[model samples]
Target chain A: MEFPKHLKYSREHEWVKVEGNVAQVGITDYAQSELGDVVYVELPEVGTDVEANNTFGVVESVKAVSDLFAPVTGSIAEVNPQLEEEPELVNSDPYEDGWMIKIEMNDPSELNDLLDVDEYKTFVEEESK
Target chain B: MAEPGDALRRTSLYETHVAAGAKMVPFAGFEMPVQYTGVIEEHHAVRQAAGLFDVSHMGEFEARGPGAAAFLRRLVTNDVSRLEVGRVMYCTMCREDGGIIDDLTVYRLADERYMAVVNASNIGKDWAWMAARKGAGVEFRDVSSETGLLALQGPRAEAVLAGLLPGGGDLGAIPYYGAQERTWQGKRVLVSRTGYTGEDGFELYCGAPDAPALWEALMARGGGEGLKPCGLGARDTLRTEMKFALYGNDIDEATNPLEAGLGWVVKFQAGEFIGREALLGIKERGLSRKLVGFEMVDRGIPRHGAPILAGGRNAGVVTSGTMSPTLGKAIGIGYVPLTHAAEGCEIAVEIRDKARAARVVETPFYRREKA
Candidate 1:
């Protein structure tokens, strides 16, 4: 429910924090809560090329499995190694320690296609209703 | 996934489940709660303390008449004649080819009457199957829509039930698989010391109209003792930990009782049942494949339909798998070639496109020590 003003979100509920040419990606708090008790996180290997709106990995909960979609096109620079041993981090701290991958943006202009904080909040509210 | 407009059926406790913030999902054509607080929390509560579940979606059928017992004996694999009044026996109904129709529990309410509780999804199918085989002198009644069932399970079940239905003649005296008729808040209810979870528990069967009131009473009375309201998610994990065979998952029409490791319930000596001849032949010919329990020696959890491999050859497929809440590790049940089904045998489970090392182990992965 908490959509931070500084982050951009995708329709699939992933959030991206933009910096100078580099961006950090993780699923939003809403996404983590919807998928309960995450048991395993499968991430793409580092140095892999990931395109915007494509699946980069899988997130598995006890009851279901969901795809982790990339919000923006990029070349993966770093993958979250901590998730391999403790996937519950995604449930506990989805924004900070649970950041899945860091991407060197292919074209920062793609950020304009993503939803801002207010728009993402409205999207979540309407989708849930 | 069920369509959004599929018109899922609701149980009598539907409102109560919603009010408690349960996550409802479409299961077996019913809108049932998959979890209340959380699956793991509810699972641990039942293992360490107690939990209550609304199992009203299950079906109940009544067979009554002078020939009721005999009619039932012809359909199911178990010996229904051995069940005394106020006792229950786990049984399986199979086709003529030895394929299981459904696994159920037959309750002997009286000398000339019996009730069979079956899976919710198999109610219509099982009803038609039994009705087509009905003989003279017996009346069949489909009482499923009018009945309500609740399972209060865990180690502390007896103490909690004693508080609600006081002076019920020492409920502890009711042995496992035993049933007794008792009055609860003015309604006659059937109380049975039985459960799907491998624990000391009791199931309460009553009229549909009293379901809401009974659930409320159980929660209010047992809440102090940490009896959490559980859902189907925990029910699944608990049963999987015990390696209990689930109907559609572990055993289906394509699988027979002899190969599914349910031979103990098929009493061949008890005489002429629907699948007796085929099962007898199967027993004589030796099993081709066997259901075996396995635990992951690697990381990743195995899921339903995952292929089991022995030396890179397709051995079988996983029927049921879960991250056991009690054992804190991944475990599963699957069928494999008879030659590869022994304990400590090595096999790999295909998980996420990679074969993960797993070892065939003895069931039940978890067991509560008798106190």
Candidate 2:
């Protein structure tokens, strides 16, 4: 699992990369590995308001379906349209091309409540145990 | 995750599975591998080449005596009397009310000896049902714990398995649904040309202690041929693509064989069986709900328990579903009203609160060419 220090992580196994008022959201590497082979990704519509820690979408693998929670409160500015055709990108490159949605942050301060790389790593370790 | 304190049972190949980096999960009381490498990779391996699977968790029972054939004939919906020695017949065991007890395969080992392989989850229940129906001259034995089964499936299955037999017996002599005794590592084993996946495959049955060795030997010999070790996940997807009815998902005690589109297995000419009267009545009354195969005409994937809609009204529910790796389309089996079960009928599957458009289609969605 690669946890980049520059990004913020959520306990739900999602990572957030914030720049100015816009933030990019995607599942962490740990999440994709746990999900095995992702076959479909159901994304929220663009411009949909999502609250922090609330479910905004669903990620379906071959065996199970999992909820994708929002890391911070915002409206979805854009959804990666490429996921519609190739959901495996979420498994291949979860942090880059697999980025799910872009959100225009409603409260940028909400990012502080999210875990840093070190904190997220500790959380993952504890959960696995 | 397999916790040490959990009461999950382990199969004979548990250590082998662990050594191979399998992800173990509790399934039907056994800690079984849900995946080894990945579902898609393992699935394609079975389709294009061959895949090995440890299906030891499934239950097996033997009936032997002078009246074994007679005793067994009254249990299943299929005509077991028609089953010749060295052949197998797929059938459903049902309660008197026409509710299915379990879908099983009956293998005629001899004129006076037979075996019934049942779903692991229904082992205890099915055993009790059979035992209660036991007669004076037949004997019953639960051989599930002592026996292990492995499925070697796909296009290249014969080539791979033929390498394991010492004298290199002509495996082609075993026709589909045929079973014969063979020697493996000096131990007599039963090899059946039957599988849930619609592929050219053989199911090998042996003593529990011989399972790991058999698995290891086959893997070592077939590794170069791309014979990957598959798990229940791939087994499920492959069977779903073939439209094979799973016991719990597709045909449970509440769902009769007729309603599940297994009427072919119900032979009225075979005389009285457990569910004969009820099934005959059902046939006379016609079907209200029928299980039909459908493909998503829209974007979303249909999942188990998803409500099916006909003309925007609640119709039925999805029983087994998956995004088929081979077909590359979202496909599912569900019980819809007879009116909506017709092929090419437009329907909607409620997926994650959204009604996705779909259409009823012909079953056995994926079939391999006869070699």
Candidate 3:
């Protein structure tokens, strides 16, 4: 379970890495581990507008189907092309190559409401119990 | 995630499963492991090497009497009278109206002694149905609670079972769907060359108390050879890949044999059975809808209850479906109108309100080559 100190995480088990007005989004390490061996990933188009806390995509493991929620209000800037051919990257390297999308934020201040490295770790611990 | 709750029954190997880091889930009224390691990994192990499955939650009923063969013949859709000693027969026990009660396998231990293994969840219902139709000369006993079953499946299953035998006994004598009794570790055990997975495998029926030790022994002997302890998740995917009909999902009380692609099991000439007459009627009237295997032409995963569409109208429903771990493609089994049930027919499965392109295909999507 690796959580980079600079990224923000959502209660829905997604992580956000913000740079300027763009934010890269991917599921957290805890999230990918819980969902064993991802078989398929469904994401929105690059220009699609996604609201915060709303479902923007679906990730299907062999035994379950999980919804991916947007951590902040944004429009899709980019989507990972590698995931189409290699969905298992979500299980192997969830933080880096497995990133789902990049969003151009509508309200960058929304990042304040998200959890930091320490806060997200604590939140995950409570959720697991 | 829903908790299994304290009321769910536990199998004898419960402690061992927890120790092995299995993800436990509620299944068939028991706290059963849904997976260990992962479903795909465990699935490939079963197809490539060997996999051990603790199917002790399945039910077993013993019938012994002067009329045991005749009684069982009348109880199921298959011809039980032709089941010689040491052989096994697969069939469905249906009601008089031809609704399936349960699908089970009958093992003929002797000329007048047999065992019917049923689905774990249907034990009570199946038992009552049989007992109500019990005759004066037939005696039925529910031995489900006292029996533990383990399926050793894959290419290396033969070597694994032969290693555990008392004195290096070869399994060549036990043909497919054949059973042999042996005193294993001083306990009476029946080793049957039968399995639901599309692999050459064997099932071991032993005392319930002996499950944990037996599981440990097989794991220790076969683990080094790539035999992993699999769970219900792997069991499901393996059977689904073979297109084996599940009792609740594919064939239920409302589904009959002829339309479910099990007409061969319903042998009217094999003598009297509960649903023989109704099945004959169904055959005469012709099938309106039939079960067919399909492959997704699009990227969506078709699931059970997904509405099937064909010729721009509602056709039928998906009975069983999944992303095939071996085929690397999404495969599903569902009922479609007879006009759209052919091997090359074009159909669409509506997944999450959007129709996805799919085409009917031949069944048993993945068959293991004889090794």
Candidate 4:
């Protein structure tokens, strides 16, 4: 599973790429791989307020439906509309085109609590073992 | 997420699944393959070409003796006498209260021999139920462990099978829901022109020892046509698109066939049966709830057990749902008040905290190519 060195990941398998006050969030490659062939994505509506670690959306794969938790507290700025048509992007390019939502980080400091790429990799490997 | 010593049972082809990079999951007490290659790809392959499925986890029971037909006729809802030798019929086993015991396919091998293929999880329960109703001269044998079953399904399934077996070109004329004894790789096999997926396909039943070889042989022959080893994930989605009733999810002991929309299979005129009286009364009293299909209008998926609502009141729960690989839309099957069972009835399904708008639609979200 690819965990980009620049991004931050949550225990729930969501990843965040923060740029100043705006942050782009999506599920990790590890998450998409485990979920398998995502069929539907429920993204938080734009301008919706979301709390860190709280469920803001859901991802439905062929096998099961899973909650997509917010990695950091923020007001949703934009949600990926493309996911409504092609949820498999979460499986194909989870970190880039599959980005679920943009959020105006309410407490950017919360990003520190998220795992870095190296730490996230170790965490996933240990979990798998 | 391996659980140590979970004791999940293994099918004869369990090792083969693992070798194919299958994602194994605990299902009905067996370590079964949930996916191989992927769900969507396998699902598409089954729609366009042939896909092989290792369905050995399904249970098979043999009922033989002079009274076999009479015994099964009373046990299941279908009119077993209607089946000729070498034919199969789908039926539902109902409790005395008219609730579903399990959905099964009955295969008549001869005048005095029959085979009932049941869901794996309901084997013990169904066995006990059949034993209690067993009368003199009928013998029931639990052959689930010794038998291996595989499904070869798709538009080109017959072509693929004919390419592998000598004189197999006639398999295309077997007719849907027909079964016959055949020889494959020196083993006597039972090839049935029946399947759970809504596709023209054949189900092969053979000894457990021959399952791996058969699967490998078919896969090798079908490789040129984009045939993939499908797992239960694709199988579930494929069957769901056809609105096929699954045992635990769609019909359970707590729900009767009448409410599950299987009343047509219950032959009340065929004389007395185990649940005949209750089911006949249900037919007279009218159904209060009925299983219906629905499509999500708003964003979100309606998962199994998700509450279904009509005018903000609880109407039912989703029994099965998926983004149909064929339809490219979220579709599900659920039970609702009989008043709301008509096609085009607007409804909503609660997914998480949001209620997604949906409309009751006609069943069989997908259709197979005509034979």
Which candidate would rank higher by lDDT, 1 or 4?
A: 1
Prediction 2 TM-score vs. true: 0.98
Q: Where in model 4 is the C-alpha error above 4 Å? A: B1-6
Q: Model 4, B50-86: lDDT tens per residue?
A: 8999999888999999989899998999999889999
lDDT string for model 3 (B50-163, tens) is: 999999999999999997888888999999899999999999899898988899999999878999999988988998889888887888999998998999999998888778
Over 4 Å off in model 3, which ranges? B1-6
Which candidate number has the best DockQ? 2
Q: What is the C-alpha local distance difference test score of each model?
A: 0.91, 0.93, 0.91, 0.90
Question: Model 4, range A1-129, lDDT digits (tens) per residue?
Answer: 687999989999899998889989999999999999998888767899999989898888888888889889889999999998888899999999999999999888999899998889999999999
lDDT of 1 by residue, A1-129 (tens): 577899999999999998899889999999998988887888888889999999999998877879889988889999999998888899889999989999999999999999999999999999999
Q: What iRMS does model 2 reach?
A: 0.7
Q: Candidate 2: which stretches are off by over 4 Å?
A: B1-6
Tens-digit lDDT track of model 1 for B131-202:
999999999999999999999999888778888896843797678999988888889989999998898999
Clashing pairs in 4: none
- Report how far off residue B21 is in candidate 1 (Å): 0.6
lDDT of 1 at A42: 88
